[model samples]
Target: MIGPNLIPVGIAGLGSYSPKRILTNWDLEQIVETSDEWIFQRTGIRERRIAEDGEDSGKMGAVAALRALEDAKLSSDRIDLILCATTTPDKPFPTTACHIQNAIGAKNAGGFDINSACSGFVFAFNTAAQFIATGMAKRVLVVGTEKLSTILNYEDRNTCILFGDGAGAMVLSPLDEAGRGEYLGGSIQTEGGKDDVLEVPAGGSTLPTDKRVLEAGLNKMVMGGNRVYRFAVSTFVKLVRQAVEPYGFEQLGRIVPHQVNQRIIESALEKLDLPPETAFSNIHKFGNTSAASVPMAFDEAYREDCLIKGKLACSVAFGAGLSWGHFLVRW
Candidate 1:
């Protein structure tokens, strides 16, 4: 199941949605001890989108999925599977995928959710691709949606400045022999041992929410930025190297990576001897939308014409399972 029986898969359509609210660095400047310049220099992010009180990942993802369906010239009922990737869902029960499916009127679509923190979208995309490849499905909708603003501890400037809320969706269908492009090979890996370095202290079975947990400030996100940064850079470089292997960077049209940090992307690309221009990033505008980062970047790059049809693209991401993975595609 792991090797050699590959089948060609390609992106059929793409769309992304971002909330209307703008949270500028200057706005954050008033809330924390940080300045716009400091935040820019450190994360290469100037602003990010914030979901309104009633907005959730499901709502945003449904919008994105509808747009993708429109882009592909397909109807919602045509989709065979729907995969929702997110860290922040509207509720604990009724997976976000169900919400999107219901919202979009995708009665025929079987759906579920995936939580790989930031690396979720790519993981979901590849998993859906495999289903198509195996002849188990014909059309799949994969969405990376996040309401990170809800979980973030605004008091912690370190984590607050690094995330945002958004959703990105893409349609996947098998490619014919003469199709314009194909999804080549890629890898997904995680280092569970390193989970302690980055996590939310409570709200899960390990530390269910209680007044004490709330009073102790254990219900929000917590991150060891320095350690995560180090791991990010190393894991990023390794994934790229492994993904490119025999095919090589020269065959790639662009590298759309998880928008965790500009510095990490730049450093990892530099370490890999890859050109700066080859990396496509929208972090400056959206910060890190966790699982939404890679797909959001992909959608933006496609809109900007950076992701031209018939060109190869590599998507790499690292997130909280201490999860890190990469996928290759041709647009």
Candidate 2:
């Protein structure tokens, strides 16, 4: 697992935000043909957040980004790059990152969007780290945010019950001169042939949005549950191994996995023979926030003192396009 050399990068700060509106399983039962017990048994998500009308991904992302900058004790002007990892952009032409940059007053930063679905945060973080590692950017802000409720088909109990809205952000910069920060590289794999396994069936370039697409629900997310469950379990195990192999078992401090499903995390970790405590899960509170899951969970673990400066932390995720990725950082 020894990999190519990389310049060390550091996590400058972290912050996250979930909407105030909570949609519990009981509430879901009233709207959809599902039960709390059934949802709990399968997904382990007791509740999830939903944005109020007019609160889009960009707005939520802006708040999280500001908090992240505050945590790092830096101003918005210091940010030279803003990478937003999201699937539910406010619009296709103006990226959610653009709105966030302006909202947070990051006038000096160049902003863009990354749409790798659930794996977006991990992908964006690694991409932003390279900027610091190669001296392309001094300070970067990476945010994983989603407004999945906007694109969910409530009539479909399967997909509707599994998604939520939220955002998580992190600040990245060159390692401190004291050599306290480190960035260990990770791996990513994609199975394009399996792209149809999980995705929004329409609303993209090929399947441009139309009244028919909207009426048919093709514009919303549709997943092959059985296929995705199997893929996720195997992919999680593979990504975790790649994420930890470079540092060995002893140096592996913690794993912050995407909160897609509690059962998926449990099954994968059990197969890997790692104790449940080694991984973190917030699905019960946040549900499947797509790109927001990993970073949101990582922030919770960090606040509890689990992710310390000398300890290593690995975050991994899997999502649409059959994409999966791992990212390791030393806080």
Candidate 3:
């Protein structure tokens, strides 16, 4: 078992990045059989960022990481480890984290990428926290980024309207206090049976890309919207209760959930008896950036002073792998 005197890990800084190119709902009308009203009513997304053709997952992650390092008043050389979580990587080999390391000039730090769908950031956070708590690393950079627009099928209204491109990052370091500064309390669960509900149909080793497969657009994300929605609502409520209740946060200050959809957020709030305002949502501005959504919302909250010192904040997310988890932090 871990010792009670173990070093406490706290978030030293936070940052996020969204491409300047905006893709509004009006852009969808020309491509799919949907209108702004229909998409807005169902998903609460009006616009989302689309990375430029030259920008890939690695570059976006690097941008966000640099901002985080700046916020911490630390340089890249000071970092001990870098963990980049993403579903869309520049390539399978070199590891996206390595690319970010190169971009940021963190020559001393070595890291890798994690592919846990939306639960990726939380997983990476937990992993980095362990390293800090155990004295393996002094400072670690955890980033979640994606260029989903590249893999999305613009013709499919249902899925296309639900995704966007962006990145978010955090600097985790050991805290002097015990049980202070971003103490995460929750369990991570995955139901492989429901994995098929949301997935990219092809293009990996199981189904390598080919001319015929390319023509059929097999590399794009395909989601069963209704099924995933049902699972998300249920999981969000359960994880929130489990994480905050034990800590006695009956009046939890803020909840930064994954910006998947407005409806899903409302459903989870209703089930948890939380007021609509208790949840911080930017789906309208950034769509579902998957793993990046929670941290992106966090950076916005901090900038707007929505998360005050001593306030209890909870971050929750659910996604493919049918995976879900929660992290509670005292700012």
Candidate 2 vs candidate 3: the lDDT winner is 2
For 1-331, candidate 1 gives per-residue lDDT tens digits of: 2246756787878889999999999999899889999999999999999999889999999999988888777899999999999989888879999999999999999989999998899889889888888878888999999998877888889999999999999998877722433777666777787667878878888899999999988878888759989989998888878877667667778889999999999999899988898899889999999998888898888779897576678899998878988898776
Q: In candidate 2, what are the lDDT values of residues 88-198, reduced to their tens digit? A: 999997889999998999999998999999989989988998887878998999999999998999989989999999999989887782143367776666678676788
1 versus 3: better lDDT goes to:
1
Question: How many clashing residue pairs appear in each of the predictions shown?
Answer: 0, 1, 1
Computed on alpha carbons, the lDDT of every model, listed in order, comes to 0.87, 0.87, 0.86
Reference-based lDDT, residue 191, model 2? 70
In model 2, the worst 10-residue window by lDDT is: 1-10
Tens digit per residue, CA lDDT, model 3, 214-283: 8999899888869988888888888888878866756488998888789999999999888899899889
